[model samples]
Every structure is written in structure tokens, then in C-alpha cells.
Target: MDLYAPFVRHVVAPLHALYEGNPIYSILRELEQTQWLSPEELRRRQWEKLERMVRHAGDRCPFYRERFAAAGLDPARFTLEDFQRLPALTKADIRKETPRLQAEGMQDVRIRQGRTGGSTSVPLEFVVDERSAQRKGACALRHNAWAGWHPGDKVAMVWGATDVDSTFKLRMRNLILDRRFALDTLRLDEAMMHDFARRMRSEQPRVVYGHSHSTYILACFMKKHGYAAPTVKTVVSTSTVLADVERAEIENMFQCKVFDRYGCEEVSLISSECDRHEGMHINLDHLFVEFLQNGRPVGPGECGEIHLTDLTNVAMPFLRYKVEDAGTPTAHVCSCGRGMPMMEKVQGRVADFIVTPDGRVIFGVSILDNFTAKFMGLERVQIIQDVIDHLIVKIVRGEGFDEKVVRGFQDRIPEFFGKEMRYDLEFVDEIPREISGKYRFTISKIPNPFQEAAGRAIGRTPPA
Candidate 1:
């Protein structure tokens, strides 16, 4: 061990934490120790923290206080089951009740602004506590270590909306943090891709990370042009679903493993794949995740909507906050021997669901993934379900894609959604991204009819 570890931990790190108002290094130190505990030990510690969080929310938040009272919870004697009795926090709640949900002393908290891509037509502008960002950074550092990358390692991002301003402060920070380069993924033409490849050769970043589709496209371009660039040790795929073929192709071209990460802007670093690759481990020490189907906790291996409680983000406690994403829980321990439990996969988002006239909800993301990838000459596709009967399909035209493909879509899509469905497939040169500059493969406008009635239907006892 380095002799300065003591000086840095006891002196230098504390100064940084005080200045930044985030105990990043301190949390990182704690996280390193927590990962070694057994699964039961981890759960025991997590449960204790969760109990405190529940009581804190009930005491500090006016909205949660009212909810607690309604659930007959005596905050002093609350159990885990009593905590689950609280209602799920929905996006509408975030939009309308943020002030009510916020803690009483939030006025002095140093909060940061965050926003979603607004694919739901109601974009959310929420605030995160300053420390949540720090904790997330620490979790990321811990995960990156699994890929043989460390805190100061150079990493290039093939991502969108990167701030590349030449301001002195920004430049100094980027240099210090080792943000060597960030490829503008918005423009991936031949020249841009070639320049990106050239930059990778020059920068030799230890890790290359980006959107799953963008990474796959870059891999394809590199193979097509036969441009051999210096290798990066690992590539991280996030922000969208990573298809099986996309993961295989990216790994083959980059000659490194592609680790899939699942998260949203609302909560950061939800789950990540370790080197063993058996499944993605949940960040249990910081988050408590529940898989709910029909408003009840689904057992392991069953699919459900992801409900998360942030143990670390105390500024705005989103207890049992619905993530609007579907996921499955794993039953077994990982072969790698990590203490954290596993989440099999983030199935997809509810915004991607296709709802029908009779209240049928279809997991459109998976269905579309299955159909589109099988067909040739299909660059991209988005399913827009504005109405129950008429489905507007947008496609990026590729070679050999013409009227015959449109006829095939007319048959295949309706057969999957419902026989009564009508398809109007429109071919386009490109499908522009949302205002947030993030790509969503599917956008559904039809409201989920079962959302409101789910709680009452799912094993709820009738009142006396």
C-alpha cells in the first residue's frame, strides 16, 4: 500500500469532500469494505439503513407523513412490510407534488437540476442532493474497477450532448479527471467515424464507453473501413437496451468485453454487470429494489415493474418510486462471489408498451426487437401507438428495403399487437432524437389502463 494513503484519507480527501459538499472518497472507502460481506450480512445492514430511511421520510416529508398515517404506520415502530404499504411514487407525483414530497429543511440543501428526455410528453425536472452525485460517482468507480479500469484511468465516451467548451475551468477539470475525449455520437458519418477512430489511436483511452447502438455502429464502421486503432480494455453500454447481437459485435470488434449497465436519470447506477457476466448486481447498499407485477412483489424469476428506494438520496426520498421500467429478479448467487444480489435484466420501459382498446398491454420493446433484427434492410424502427387501432410505424430505410418490406411489416406487426391493428409504415432517411438528444427506439402515447386499478386488484384486502 502507498504510504500516503493515510495522509490522503485523513487529510486531503476530507478537504475535497468539504469543498465539494460530497464525501466521494469517504463513500468509496465504505463501499470497498461493504462488498466483502456475505449476502445475508449485506441485507441485514441494508435493512437497518432502509428502516432509518423510512422513518426519516415519514418524519421529514409532509407527503410521506400523510401516506404513513394512512397506512397506519407508527413511524417509531415501522417494519419493512409497513414500508411496502406506502403507495408507489409515479411520474405525475413528481411533476405535481415535488414541493410536498420534499423534506422540511430542503431550502438550504445544495441540490442539482436533472431532466428526462420527455418521451412521456411530461418531462420531469427534478433536483438531486449534492451528495447523491458523489455516491453515484463512488459506485461507478467501484464498478469500473471490475473491468480493470480505475479512478484516474483515461476514458472516452461515444455519447451525445457532451460539453466540449474550451473554458479554462472545464479544461482543467477534464484533464484532472482523465476525461480524455468524448466522441460526438450525434454525427456518425464516414468522416466523423474515421476521425473518432483516429482519436482513439492517439488518445489510447483505457476504456471506451457509449450508447449500445452507437458502439455497435462504430464496430461496424471500423470493420467496413478496416481501420485498426489502439485497443481499449473495456467498453460500457448504457442509455438503451443492449441486444444480444449488438453486444457480440461490439465485443468482437473492440476485442474487449462489453459490460451492460442499467439506470435512469431519476436514480443513478441502479445495476451493473461484473466480470463473471452471470447477471447484473444490484447496488443494494445504496438502493432497495422491488419487482412488482400487478402491484405485488413478484418472486424471483418473475417479471415486474421496477420499484426503487434510494437509501443515499436523502434530499428527496423517493420511497418505492416506480421506475416505469420492467425487470426480473435472479434467484441464485453469482459464481463471482459478490455479496450484492442480482437483477436478471431490465426488460424495458413502460413508455415502450403498446396498449390496446381492450386494455391489453404488450411489451412492445421486446416484440419489436425480435421482429426488426430478424429482417434485412432495416436500419432502425420506432413504434408510435397514438391510438389503439392505428399504429404509426417509422423506419429508417436501408438497402433492399422497399414496398415488399412494408407489406411484410403490415402483416407481422398487426399479428403481434392484435389482429384488429392497422399499420401505416413510413420510411425515412433518419429518425431524429428527442429534445434531450437521447434516442428512444419506441414511443407509446396510449395510457396504461390497468395502472390505476392494479393496487386494488393485486391481493388487497377488502376494508371492513
Candidate 2:
């Protein structure tokens, strides 16, 4: 037998077993049941949980202990205000503190090491324990519950990853769960897309979940061929930005509700769109979220970078972690009766913002919607803005490609800025995937003088 087989059976399999039956899953179920709680009651319980997590981190995590002390505060006496006083932690901070954050005398404090898909070009490495991994899975399940799916419901996952080799244990688990996994690491060609649609229709999954881009590509294919996956109850989009236009198109083609989820590898579920679809409801029970602009808290309905603390993950607690995404906070109570504050909109990642020559910022997602609405037979597209006046449109086209689609995209962009802008369309055979096998929608190459002057400047380079 292979030498590694023993390790998988003894270590990995057992860990997986523990993860599937952990208390985190139970906690998630409990939260799902509390979706009917009043706004005030939900707020009270969220704060109580946040305080407990803060105290736990102060007592167990050395990094947080030093942080609390340096701020001239006591963790035991910590309140919501005191928690807000702590400095926000960025990806750079986590990289710098990796060694110190590890537990004493432990060779590998991380039970698992997760790699970000390099959506920002600066792919992150986050460590998670067994409990944290379980929590992440449970949170994902709760999001699926929004679409009326149960634990054993048949589902199909179309996602990209660097590691494509699945072990025997994983295969068995998939079989037991009645789920199918599709690898969309390559561009969606006509033949491949046809095969995918065939499999999807035959399988008749309860829900389909994957990257928003890939899902949209599939939906486009179905729309053109007059095919629909009628049995699929829901199409869940994650891992990348999903525009309203794309969501509507997907729902129309797939004949299901499009539930968009937002989160990172560090924390499992941050916020999810509810049944009412008013906005994303923040998972305040498991996370404490803040919107910060210029290092200060922004009030309700203000847009800023999202800073979050994972109150559940004690092994590698992220205290005020800068998520590098822009969004607006909403104090409006949801019609669904969940008291969690709504995230009115997630304006995509900071890197997705295009800085124009006149110092105007255009949201990349808004531009993507314009193209998706008018363009056809397009597999993937990336927008690169090097300067205010210069823009590059990289298009991976499908069968029967024409310049008319490109012209249509060009025509719609001006409406986004309310001004005519100069851009060049370049058709390519493929848009290269990033190191982690995910495609980024936009990249800015123009160097920011402030970042360059700091001498820690890193250039932005999108894959291909």
C-alpha cells in the first residue's frame, strides 16, 4: 500500500468525521431556528456573544492579550465600544503575526491551511482548526437553507481549485451526501458547456452552487439554446462578485431564485441575502462587522471597507480583520424579522474599483453588468484600467463571435460614467486563470504614489 494512505485513513478521515459531527454544526442549526427573533433580541444576543468571544481571545490568544493591554484596556471589562477601540488587522498584519499567533510548543497550530483564489492578486493563507472548519461548513449549510435545502438534498457544485485530485474518502462522502462536483477550471467551451448542461438536467439537483461567473456563463449557454434546468430549485453564487443583472438572467434561465453569499476563507459565512431579497443580512451571531473609512467608523448607510471579527474561530481568531471589500451598512430592520443589521450592498473588492484620470472611481462590478446584459457568447471578460483615459477590455468569446457584441459593450460603458471613455477591446482564446485557478474580473496597474512612496508598494498584475 502507498505510504500516505495510512496517514489519510488515520488522520484526515478521522478529522473529517469529527468535523461533520461537531458542536459548530449544532450551533448553526440553532441560529437557523432563530431567524424569527425580534430585532432587539437578536441585537442583544449578538452583543453578548461578541463580548464572550472578546474575553476568550484575551485569555487564550497572546496577540489579542497584548493588543488589549497596549490599548490600556481590560478584556474582562470589554464592551461593544471597547471592542471597536481595538486596531483593525489587515492581511499584512496576519502575515507578520503568523509565528506569534501559533500556540506554544505546537508544530502546526493550523489543522488546515486555506489558499485564497488570488482574486486580489495577493492570495491569502489562513489557518483553521477542526472546529473552525466545521463551523465554516455549517455556515455554508445555513446559507443553503435560505433556498429551502436540507442536509441530504442533492446539490451540484461547480467551482475551480488548484487541487483537483480527490481522495477515496472524499469520493465516498460525496456519494453518501448525494452531491455532484464539477470542475470548471478551464474556459467554458461550447462542447464542455453542453456536457455540463446535460449532466445538470439529468441529475436534477435541488440546488446549484458555484462561482457567479461560471454560473452566468452556464445560464447564457442555456438561454441561447432555449434549455432550462427546471428542476433546480436554486442557483447559489459565491466566491466572486454577482451583479443584479447577472442574477436576474440566471434566475430566468435556471428557473430558480439566485441567492448570493458573501464571505472569505478566513470566516465562513459573513452575510447572505434573505428570502425577501432586500439586502444581505450580517451573521452578527458569529461575526462582528464594522464599516470603516479613514480609520473611523462610518454611520448607517455609509460605504466603506468592511472590517470583521470572527467570533467563532478561537484557534486563529481574526480581530477586526480588514476584509478589503467595500460595502454600505444598513440599520433598516428586515421584513423577514431577523434583527441582524443588513448590508445594503457589497461594492465588490477594493481592487475592483477603477480609478479614472479625473480621480473618479468606477465600480468594476457595475461595468461587468453592462457587458453581461448586452454581450453574448462571452466566456470570460476582464477590465484593466491603467489610467483615467486608458482601459483594456479582455474578452474570451464563444462560438459565432462578432464585433457587434464588443461594440455593444463599448456603447454601454459610457452610461456607467455618463461620459465617453477611451477603451480597446482585445479578443483572446482564453483569459488565464490565477495561481489558485480563479479568474479576476478587473485589475488596475497604475501605481498609487502614496503606496509607492511608502516603499512597500506591490504592483497589481492580473493573470494573463
Highest TM-score model number: 1
lDDT (tens digit, per residue) of candidate 1 on 1-464 = 22443454356546756787676777888998888799999999998888888888887999888888998887788777877788898877888998887777767777777766444456666677877767777887778777776655567777765664468886875665445577676655678888888888777776777777677778877876787746778988876667787788888888889988777777777888999898899999889999998778999998888899988777888889887677789887888888999988666632266776655786654655577776777777777877778778888876667777877777787667778887788777887765433455666666663333221101100000
- Displacement of the residue 209 alpha carbon in candidate 1, Å: 1.4
**Model 1: which residue pairs collide?**
none
| Model 1 superposed RMSD (Cα) | 6.7
> TM-score for every candidate vs. truth?
0.84, 0.83
lDDT of 2 at 201: 73
Residue 33 miss distance in model 1 (angstroms): 2.3
lDDT of 2 by residue, 1-464 (tens): 22433454345544655675666456666868776687688778877777777777777778878989887668778666777788888777777787555444344444777555343445556676766676666666677778665555556666764122377766786655334557464554678778878887777677787777667767877777877674876777775667777788888887778888777667767888878888898887678888888878898888877888877666677889876676788878778877677987676542255666666665667667654546776767788876667778888887666877867777776665546467888888877765444565777666542221111111111110
lDDT of 1 at 299: 92
Report backbone clashes per prediction: 0, 1
Candidate 2 worst ten-residue window by lDDT: 455-464
Best by lDDT: 1
